[model samples]
Target: MASSDTYAAHAFHHSFDKERASGAITLTDVHVQFHNDQGQVRFPVSGTQFSLGGASDRLLFIRHPSEPDWNIYTSDLSILKHPALQNDVQIQRRVQQIKNKRRFTWGVFASVVMVLVAIPLLVVLFMDSLTGPLARHVPPEWEQKLGETAFAQYQMGQDFLKQEESDQLLDPLLQPLLQQLQDERYPFQFYISSDDAVNAFALPGGIVVINSGLILKADSADELLGVVAHEISHVTEQHSVRNIMGTAGVYLTINAMLGDMSGLLAMVANAAPYLINQSYSRGFETQADEKGLALLYRAQIEPEGLVTFFEKLREQEQKQLDKVAGEDNRESIESTLQFLSTHPATEDRIDHLQEQINELPHQNTLDLSLPFTTLQERVKRFVAKEDEEPET
Candidate 1:
């Protein structure tokens, strides 16, 4: 019963209703018709405000003040490309800018994470190569300063044997070795500590300290010379300084990459303590042993003394191990010997020293039997005197 024009309008409305239900909208007579989950709705653009929502390259997003959710449209849809949008240039530009910003933000975040993960890996993989060169940059004066600081810290609250007493015992033994080494680059000063640990260590700036226990442990002056030469080699080779710089360099580089400057002062403050307590790496120990043997050869001292000292230590360690009942007890006892702990007198090391000894031509070195015996007795008397004195 309807006229054809009325029927045509009704058909168009029916089609629009279906399209709007699926989140599609078209502008007609300055009004937008769309359907939300609530069903078909229409609003006049004159009263509604437009806003851009989330969008992608292939999709356009639009929001209206009357709607709770954004209405999505295909970017290539004719309705979106309509010339009518040109009148709302501000809205279109804002939408495009926001999309670009989102993409850029995500890209930057991903790139940052990737770089953060890569920096430490690269540093660790190339650490040796980098640290060797970086260590060379530390000046000799700085090395000396570090050594002095560490030595001062080490001597705190400790009873050092009088200089006169130390020289009387050590100078006669050390002077000939020094004369042979002929290294005048550093002022090498030796000191003896009253501590009963059979240990000797070299500071960065040619400062070597030997415990009285080490003096008592040596069988001959050549044996003591071997230990002194090894310690001297550590100083001459700048091993301590190199080690400190290498470790600090790695820590600083990591902190730098992370953009953290807060802990740098603390690290520097702890440097002296770290150097004092740090054990030399096996590579460093090997180098010192090789150079020490060479120094003994140059000094015309018997390299066999070095080998003999190590054998004695091995025998002593075995004796201690034999006394222990269980494997765990043996392990624990081995860990307690500070000399072996620090020097690590492994079988391979002993074998290597013997091989070096075999290559050397046999010669009669200085007869140090009498002086070494006197020194050992003196050390025992000094230790006994300390025990008799009350703690002040």
Candidate 2:
């Protein structure tokens, strides 16, 4: 551990009195040892705090749980180099910043509350919205590291498409999106899962998992990229991280991020499965749709792909619904079957998407012209082969 020489400092003479005392204090990365006429004492640096405008603003004001009345002061700025002090300051600064972002002025709140009262079903969206501010404060590097850890845990015991298989299908389609990339924080990654569902989900940071079934159902690169773009919007907007933070209490999430990383790790470990099963809020889904449409526009691709894709999901969902019940009884049973999917497509959502598409101006979009039929066959063949392999 790093240590410093004994430095001259002063503290309260007695734990009970206001009298001052002289002491020689030594600093270490983990502990601060003070020796005086009163004897020796050690305080763990993890709990030590420093701030300005205490007994002596000119000198560093050190406070410790062990010496509540000590009111220690040191002229030597080297004490600030202590790991505990640095970490405490950093965490406080970050927490304050995140908290500040989450707070709004009364004027703004008053105006927003008016709009919110008109929309009560979306109040749940605002309840979860608190997590977004904190999510943005998590440093990109930390976010990436945490996501990789969670993703590793999630990938275990899951059937994912082979790298080559995924690369052949996705790399070309992702080019336009990649070309329009703006954020430098996350190393955006995409993977193809071998699940038999036409769905995709985003992991915290920039990891997006697309099911092979979605790809198999898509007729062209445009359709697949549309879904991929929506999922990417979830990553870029920090929705995945927000969801994770929301699932874990905000206090726990903030504390875990700024204090004990183990709490954060354990929470994500237990919650990773739920993350996969979790659905975006209607509000969150709408935001993703709009942002994803913007992404498609910026990439110079036809934005209508999203509309078509949503319509496709809606059709398939209807077919599934028809298989279970006749059309006459479908309305009564649709609510019960809502639990069967995390991604719920609706006529309203599709119509809203179409309205959005109508607003866009014409663009000479790139035609990827991917060999969808051949690729679909390849995906089918590989999935079947993998499914037949014996587990060793």
> For residues 1-392, could you state the per-residue lDDT of candidate 2 as single tens digits?
57465778887646423477778788766677777776666787766666544332346666778867567777775554445445565535643443343343444677788866645434335545655665666667666666676678778787776666567777777878877978766787877777788888887778888877887888777787788889888888877666766666544754644665556545554554556556777667888888888899999888888888888877887898899999799987787666554444476678888888888888799787655555677678766874444221
What's model 2's lDDT at 279? 74
Candidate 2 stretches greater than 4 Å from native: 1-125, 250-273, 335-345, 371-374, 386-392
- Which 10 consecutive positions of candidate 1 have the poorest summed lDDT? 2-11
lDDT of each: 0.66, 0.70
| Model 1 TM-score, all chains together | 0.59
Candidate 2, after superposition: displacement of residue 212 in Å? 1.6
What number of clashing residue pairs does each candidate have, in the order they appear?
0, 0
**Collision count of model 1:** 0
- After best superposition, candidate 1 residue 375: deviation in angstroms? 2.6
